[model samples]
Target: MNFFSYLASYFDFDLKILPYCIGLSLDILILYPLLTYFKWHLLSRLGVTLKDKEVIFSSRKNNFNLAYFVNKYGDRNLRIADGLSRKLLHIFSGIWHLVFLNLVIQDTRIAWQAAFVKSLLIIALCSLSYSSNKVFGLAGIMYGATSRIRDGLDGRKNFFIAQLAFLNLYVLVFIEYIARKNISNEDNLIFFSFFIFLPLIIGDALGEIIGTIWGKQKIRVWGVGQINRKSVLGTVSVFLGSLLPLLLVVSLNNLPAEWWLLCLSVAATTSTIELIAPRSTDNFFIPVGNALVCLIFAVYVIHL
Candidate 1:
């Protein structure tokens, strides 16, 4: 049998879904390296040096080259570059989900298969990065891409844990979809997935980027990083960023008034989690929290 057939038989998944899995893998393999290269070049231009030894050792001990930048180019430049890199990755993630969503709307079964494969690949890569001591190869590339957000002393550990938590949410949703097989509520399933991802892609990302640039008032918070201050403006950005997209989706679908309440409630939950979640761990909490709140609201409140 061919590779797709083998995978289908071995994994007990539909062979038709292999194309989506391959496409997502190719996208990550190609785009991720390019984005990492671009980020490295941009930071180098900004005089943010990431020496091999420093990246592997000093960064592990300190705060992922932030101190070097602070000493050389000042905190403002570092923050700007950090924010710009974050925006680039977040935009990529947002685009990826947009494509993934089209497939879900077309065929939930196929989409879930693709998502399950993608999640496994991501978790494997992250696990590999966590085990390696050297800052080279795939681990290096990952570090290059996410070093800013993973700036804490325990950043890599935090990143791996958070990814496990984040991807587990997707896996759980996929399980729910498969178990129910309620074709009538397929559209509702699509909406549920959209609500879970929209805030994470838009609200969480923009909150950090805007906060880095314009946030003057620092509100101290708890987290795993050296920097624990969040901006008032950034918190506002999170709420608005989440709410606006939800509103658009509701309007376009002509969803019920209850969905409007759902939108507002979700936006509030997302921003609140972002505000209070421990540093990079928000990457874990935001989606899972949104999923829980959505489930509670759907089951008890609006009876979705």
Candidate 2:
């Protein structure tokens, strides 16, 4: 089936989840960029100078500005060819990510084959977009090896960088989805959902928000010895981000009240993971490490 048929099948109205799917897509496409630009403006006023890992993303408008880059690319004509192939990639990854959420809330095994289809299709579409949008001088980005942050988005690999960098994460999610096929615990599923989303969303925001507004000192990432783009305040923010959701989980009775140690463990572990994770890969590391910590603590501490 085509993209629309695929999406319609994915979000069958009988499931009554189309709204949530739309919300997730809008969160990634619209809110994500707005927040990125918001940080650029807010941090500029605060004198944080988001020049390093602090500036994680580019504005869609800036990236699509064909007229400005024409002087460099020598392409007098430009076209976006934007559609489901382009937009669906974003929605596909997003909905697949929400599978973890579904596992938590509804005690459902993920539609594994469908999820895989979405993943591969999104990657294919992204690869196509990158090639079509490539400019002459910046064509090298097609390979995903650029070091300079801003340079990658303009190159051929432009949008695929994050996709490759999070290769580990995509594998982990697939593994977890398979594991969930036989398990049946609603609370456990919810735990999985929080474990991924908390660090991915909240921790990410905290790092950027705190690092940009209050952080004055930068430090070399522990595992990434050569990269000193991270700051202590940012690491602390990651910890807080992970910690807050754990608190909510406990409050909601999804986790036991004695989850403090586990909470701190996840916070510290994810923060450390984020600290040393390569640029754009924090989304991968943060959740994987947090998931491991959650399982270990559930078996040892909570059971004890």
Best by lDDT: 1
Which stretches of model 1 miss by more than 4 angstroms? Answer: 1-16, 49-66, 130-136, 149-152, 174-186, 300-304
Error of 2 at 123 (Å): 2.8
TM-score of 1: 0.79
Distance (Å) between predicted and true CA of 103, model 2? 8.3
Let me know the TM-score candidate 2 reaches against the reference structure.
0.56
lDDT of each candidate versus the true structure = 0.68, 0.47
lDDT (Cα, tens digit) per residue for candidate 2, span 194-225: 66556665665567446534665357443221
Please report how far candidate 1 places residue 186 from its true position, in Å: 4.9
Clashes of each: 0, 4
Q: How do all models score by TM-score?
A: 0.79, 0.56
Poorest 10 consecutive residues of model 2 by lDDT? 76-85
